[model samples]
Target chain A: MIRFENVGMRYGAGPEVLRDISFELKPGSFHFLTGASGAGKSSLLRLMYLAHRPSRGLITILDEDIATIPRNRLPELRRKIGVVFQDFRLMSHLTCFENVALPLKINGAGSGVIKKYVSELLNWVGLADQANARPATLSGGQKQRAAIARAVISRPKLLVADEPTGNVDDALAVRLLFLFEELNRQGTTVLIATHNESLIRRFRHPVLHLEDGQLVPSPLRPIVPLRDRAPPPPDSRRFSDPIYPDAPGEGGRHG
Target chain B: MAKRRGDIPLGNDPASRLLPWIIGFMAFIAALALSGALVLAAFSDRWSAGLTGTLTIQIPPPAAYDDEAGFEALQKEALAAVRRTPGVASATLLPLDEMRALLKPWLGAGADPRDLPLPRLIAVTLEAGEDVDLADLGRRLEALAPGITIDDHGLWRERLTDFMAALQLAALAVVAVVALAAVVMVIFATRGGLLAHRESIELLHLIGAHDRYIAAQFQGQTLFAAIKGGIAGTGMAAGTVVLLGHGAAATGAVLPGALVLEPMAWLWVMTVPMALIVIAVLTARRTVVNALVRMV
Candidate 1:
């Protein structure tokens, strides 16, 4: 659950990049954030992920105000939110397994839990065989899958991703959104920022479109409410290529 | 804190690579300085205690030159008068052969001591913790022999102790400066590490990692480096101290006290490395934590 009211943000003496932004993302909702090249999508995601404070106005996540939250409690608040970056941002020296296991490790999950969940999630993301390989060795699609796995490893309450599927092919991108959608069905709120109009039309979830440092109404097809929308029709590619695995701790759903 | 391998990639960085060597050098100097202070303190206390309750009396050879019996009579009379003093436990005229040995180091061992116009000396021992009336004893010895003088030894002992204390203070000051240098070096290394791993640090921080977790990883590396350097430095210092002790023992009779460190003093010297390790770890932790707190 995130609420931002009349928020304006800028970076150190720079012009305002996000102005008068206000939105409420209900629990278990999924939304795609759409914008042009200089439209401040990443900056808005940065504010959502607690990387920067709003220069003015109020932004609250998980019932705590970002501007007034004590620094010591920021980590706890951050732990409840998962973020997937456009660049993947995996540690180059770490193997894929270690990269995906980072969130769990940061959450202080027991070693047994980390091994079980990380191994299972890697297998589900079609990266089980490459688990021991470094990020440099992985293909772009493999890196994107690894990043998504890491973000969802801790089963964060809210998942905010900036261009989560930019590196993958169209088919694979559709499959990855389904992965996030599955997590959303399991009660995780997901907001994805992207410029892929086809994927936006195909997925048909709500859209929070940004333009010229401000939120604008999307002039497109009507978006479906998250809970009322039926799941994507399942196919062998979804079940066979990447095992239809539930998020790390979400049990019995795939079965 | 279980080790996080290559999380920050600090091991291969220039700052991290150089940190251990700098710490090792600082630890070496600190250990040596501390050992010097410890040995000096031990010797000063021993020499002070040795001179505390004892003194000497010197009587120049009788001027007659041929009056051997008169000189012996005057020596006996002076010894008798000193023995009668209340605080003087006993006084005996120093034998000439023993006096020759004291001068053997300065004069050639082959030279005969009898040729020199050596004064006849009397060794005085006093009651433990008792004060002797040196003025009264000097008057008595002077009446017995005009040239006789009482050597209370207090002034000479005080000077020796004062000199040793000053040297000890200087040694400790060197150790303090070395420790301060070590702290400053650690601070710089930590800062460099933070800068070098800024992206990784931010990634870690953003991925639900606490400031303490990031600091633990940095400090854990520092702890290992510091411990390794500390042991190397302290080990070298101990070996040097032992070799010097052996060298001093070869001519130990020349100096009144040999630089032999007691077990406790050696234990104190060993603590230099431990102290250095503590300082490095704390500095790295504080620096990393403070820097992280400034971030969002």
Candidate 2:
């Protein structure tokens, strides 16, 4: 869980980027962060990811005041949070397998566990066949999928994605969000920063919209929510209590 | 204590693999300069002490009319005066034949000694715990015999001392220059490695890897290479000194060359490797830390 109260950030004498930002993310909660370009979406994600320090105000992650954490203890805190960058910052020299297993390795996971977990995650993301290939050899969408696999491999407590679907076709994007939703259903908190309104409308999860360096409450929609019409579960375990059940099941098919 | 996941595989990078060779090369140079100075100092000390502890009194050849009487008269006075001096442990006027024999090496064995107008010579030796004061001794010898002049080897010893000091300075300068070069090279190599792996470095930093973790890797690698090189170089230098000692013993005469081989002093060769390892570790730590501070 992340809680920020009156948190503000700036970049070296530049204008205040995220001002008086405060929010709470409950366990297993899912939310969409929406904003136009330069709306500090990435900056806010950075703060949540523990990459940048807040210039002022209190920020807590998992009930610990992050600003007061000793530098040596930061890695342990970071291991619990996974991030997928917009650029898919994979090391070109490393194979897809190595890239995805990086987080586990940094956490000193055993070799056997890493091999099994990475294989399972890569297979889940539909890149098991390209596991031996390097990032340069993968297509944009393939790289995005690999990045998502990497982000979710460790089953991090908080998953922050910046434009996770920007490079993929619409169908793949929806499936990726479903994957994040599935993880969230299993108790991982998910926060996605994207500008795609149609996707937000399709998924009725709470939206945290940003404009002019400040948070704006998202207006609630009165339309019939998609979760109300679902068929009865064949078995109780067969269906998850969906966080974004109204999110579209299919929109644009890639193939 | 957090570990870093280095993306760049520790493979056979030519530069990294060549590290031992580079260190060995540096240690070789260090040994060459240090041992050379040691040899020079030993030789200079030996030759100067030998030459300074003795003096020769030369009486100019007697005029043709004065004959052997003039030689005998001056020789007795020189011997009598030398014997009375406090620091003159023993003084004996060299026989004409003995003086002639000294010139045989330069003039060749077949040369006739009688033909040369050799000066009358007195060879003086000094006692332990006493040094001949040349200034005072010269006045006494001159009063004893008007034509006698003394040589206490001061001019030669002074020149040798000055030359030895210069050689020691030169040796020290070489050591300083080599150490400086090593530090600079380490900085250059570290900077290049950092740039080459900038992505990994940034990722590590973002993930909260401390500066010490990054620096330790570089320092450990450098230290291993330096120690390996130092051992190899010092071994080679020791072997060379041993070989020289053998040659010197077989010759059974002090060689004219002034480089003295002190075989037992090779024990001090351990310092070369120790110094090299320390320098490398320190330089690497500083370079890595400085680079990381600039990154975040």
Q: Which candidate is the best by lDDT?
A: 1
Error of 2 at A116 (Å): 3.9
Regions of model 2 farther than 4 Å from truth:
A110-113, A169-175, A182-187, A196-204, A219-255, B1-32, B49-67, B73-119, B124-155, B192-197, B220-274, B291-295
Per-residue CA lDDT of model 1 for B1-296, tens digit only, reads 13337567778678888887888899889998998999899888888888887888898987776788888888888888989999988888888889888887888978877777789888989998788889888888887878788777889898998999999999999999999999999999999999989989999889889999999998989998898889988888888888888888777545644567889988898899899999999999999999998887
Whole-model lDDT values for every prediction:
0.85, 0.75
Give the interface RMSD values of the models in order.
0.8, 2.5
DockQ for model 1?
0.69
**Which has the greatest DockQ?**
1
Candidate 2: global Cα-lDDT? 0.75
Residues B46-133 of candidate 2: C-alpha lDDT, one tens digit per residue:
8887986788888777667347787677778778878888888889888887777788788887888788777888899989769667
Model 2 chain A scores worst on lDDT over the 10 consecutive residues at: A235-244
Q: What clash count does candidate 1 reach?
A: 0
Name the weakest run of 10 consecutive residues (lDDT summed) in model 1 chain A: A235-244
Model 2, residue pairs in steric clash? none
